[model samples]
Target: MLAGIKSAFNNNYVSAEDQGARPLIANRTAAKGWETFDVVTNADGTISFLSAANRKYVTADLNDHTKLIARAATIQAWEKFRRIDRGNGKFALQAVANDLFVCADMNLGGVLYANRPAASGWEEFTITALSSPNPGTPDSQPSTGFVVTEQQFNQIFPSRNRFYTYAGLVAATAAYPAFAKTGGHAVERQEAAAFLANIHHETGGLYHIVEANKANYNHYFDYNSKYKVVPGKQYYGRGPLQISWNYNYGAAGEALGLPLLSNPDLVAQDPAVAMKTALWFWNTQTGAGTMTCHQAMVQSKGFGETIRTINGALECNRGGGGAVPNRVEQYKKICAMLGVDPGGHLSC
Candidate 1:
């Protein structure tokens, strides 16, 4: 479903009028700056159309039945759209508030109106792919100050280089820098290094994918558990960062477009999926706190805070201790290798 949506809308520029008092309309031939929109999926399962012109959200007004406009960057319920596929190349967007589909009045020069009695041909839309705005060309999006060159990546994991592989890391790094540098726990070099270093420590420099104790794999099964183990599947640690347990695998798989709940081995077998799982864990998991590992690193909260954010209960004495110092030391070493000063706050 996500692949379908992303393939259809991810990079296209949306140009439609809002059903507001102003009746916002885009000139198809000579569209204004506010006319273009970029599609982004929210963590909460809603779809957002971010205006390419000013980077705001295409929002619906709850109070005014006919109002829809590009407004806030922060999403609310009104900003969400339920995309209804019409089985053909067409689709309709049903407003969450009134359950009425948006109607694009082609006769009125592409003006938008909603609160219709039912979804009709006028409410249906056929999306067309368009070129994304050149990323590097935008002055507003400055280069993230840190990057891990292939040369540097090779140097970081010398012994387990074969397992992690320079090519695999390069592919992962290239695929994510834009996403990592964009929002939430946006990546700076320091933050990137911290994440990589922790995964290195977790995987013993990337040699280990699945955890040990192959004999007791079935112990992961428990009826009341959140992520119920598959009847014959084992959910141990896998991937670069060792995503252990059933729940972690299920959540990560859902987010990464994989079915790891039944096929947990995918994390250990597919290099691209493995790399993505590590990133998904880092960017989303709050561990023992409100802050994600990425957020903790970039917000100047220090590497130690990230430790607490990731495994404070185990490594910071919340559940157990003995491992905090080693984590701190490893973080510092990686920061040095990356050529960035490990900023303050290095202990849990």
Candidate 2:
């Protein structure tokens, strides 16, 4: 069952209205026959939502800016959606046909449309399994399969702010499925330890939300990038990795389908978003180095390579002003906690 996040709709479940076209709307107060959808995970990893209303596949109509309608007779490209887990049982559906998120657009009287470039509050939905005793209630359990357990994470970052939740990090891992799951158990634990250690250094044991240096806040805006800096918005260091610069924000926003270029505050505001941004940089970006932080770990390149990929410009070899040694110590400590060997080449 899919429920809208907008206040105007009052978290109503989506209903495939029975009529000529069977348009999808977020006005149902309860999940019954028409409100339920069978989430089909395709062979290609894409998803197809089969509406229980008419036993038809949900289609994002390409002719109408991808308006969601349960009228497709068979599964096609327009029926495929990428489910982006937004932590806490919420998810955003991105239409494969348009490469846009499906939004419960309030402007259209709660009609669903796959037209949003980014996944904001409007695009988010709570998808509950109907098999549960309480149909609409989300599962209370934290997402599973992550290498780092909540207990282990809490023990690692006991001083972490409430915003940096273990659940949020677990949920963010869904965005990059192969994050700590890539290598074998030992390597996976090493990767998790390395990532947590880096974040610990950046956030000062997860105590800080934003960069502490206020003087450098306004300096992150880039005048020459394609991503125009929005006036009054500061692209300061934010999230676990503290992603900075207008171009980085824009690029991450584009990849994650969030308006980070304009609403950079989302990274600091939403815990799940913050973790997602951090994971985005961890799994993709190779800032100041040759390989991504993820590659540095999974490829057996050592923890030092991870540091180089993250902050080599300042911390690789030029003494790192004590930052490099601190990172190494933290990595070793975390590796010990996880019972994994702190592999060689511990310094960049």
Candidate 3:
């Protein structure tokens, strides 16, 4: 039965024409995102295979009448797959939605969909373990289980080490999973680039930790007293993402296990805490926008939407070409460096 990790087999079972999430095929060869699948035990004794890239479960399309799609975030009646064992390392994934088995149309190069009721050859698939720490090819196409590597991160930022010490940045790698989770928003390179670009703009290529021009840093404590009651401490802009205000300090502190509310200076002094706060804000906060910055980039909503997500109410397109353009330009440049398509939606 289900014991270890397994990757999707996309050997000629899917059409070459179909790509991305549409064709819904899997493959091996040490890829990160697509090649990895986690088997989960359901309460009803059934199982689910969650894709590492899309972060969704294999679901039978209720709207299209059994059209199989791997885009469900939760396990519902339509999402649970009945794994029927036919022995010899073969199993058929029968969809609970229509009681139909997952059939890979080999004729179409393997466009996965639900159509058959019986466990046949097309529905049968083999499971294996996952092992691909090899940074993935190009780092563009979505892959899982691979860290960007210190060398690559340094090369990307060049002078990043100038602000964040090598030891500190390396230590932050432990927290990389928070942003690059198997089913999280920052899993994709485009999303990663968009995040870095915004943070880079905020911190000037990781050169500064605290805001330099601002004088009334302590004003944050008085103006937003509802967040944290720090009689004299100032929760000003600090860290790579410049986490500011008492509310943000409290939230970031709570999220990263740091007492930012009591000692907001930790964000300015500690590189790991600074980066963590930045990533925390990027991955979770919606601010004035409808989605998180991670969601904006992952969903192809453009870099502009990220701006909106960060400070849309004031600094968005309405900033009169003051700040939003700067972020967009930097994001585009970073995308160019990464060799991944920027994928439109550039402005707020």
The candidate that wins on lDDT is 2
Pick by TM-score: 1 or 2, better one: 2
Once fitted onto the true fold, the runs of candidate 2 whose alpha carbons sit more than 4 angstroms away are 1-143, 319-321
52-162 in candidate 2: lDDT tens per residue?
Answer: 555456899988767889876556789889989887767788999989998888877788998889987888887766554244332222247786667768878988899
Task: Write down the lDDT of every candidate, Cα atoms only.
Answer: 0.62, 0.80, 0.64
Candidate 2 yields a Cα-based lDDT of 0.80
lDDT of 1 by residue, 40-107 (tens): 45444556565544434556666665656665534557666788888767777777656777765556
Model 1 gets an lDDT of 0.62
Score every model by TM-score: 0.53, 0.59, 0.55
Each prediction's RMSD over C-alphas, in Å, is 18.5, 20.3, 13.4
Cα lDDT, model 1, residue 106: 57
For candidate 3, give the lDDT.
Answer: 0.64
Which stretch of 10 consecutive residues in model 2 shows the poorest summed lDDT?
A: 1-10
Q: Write the per-residue lDDT of candidate 3 for residues 39-134, one digit (tens) a residue.
A: 655646676755544545667786875666666655668767788887877778887777888877667556667788786667777665443322
Record all residue pairs in model 1 with backbone atoms less than 3 Å apart, i.e. clashing.
313-319
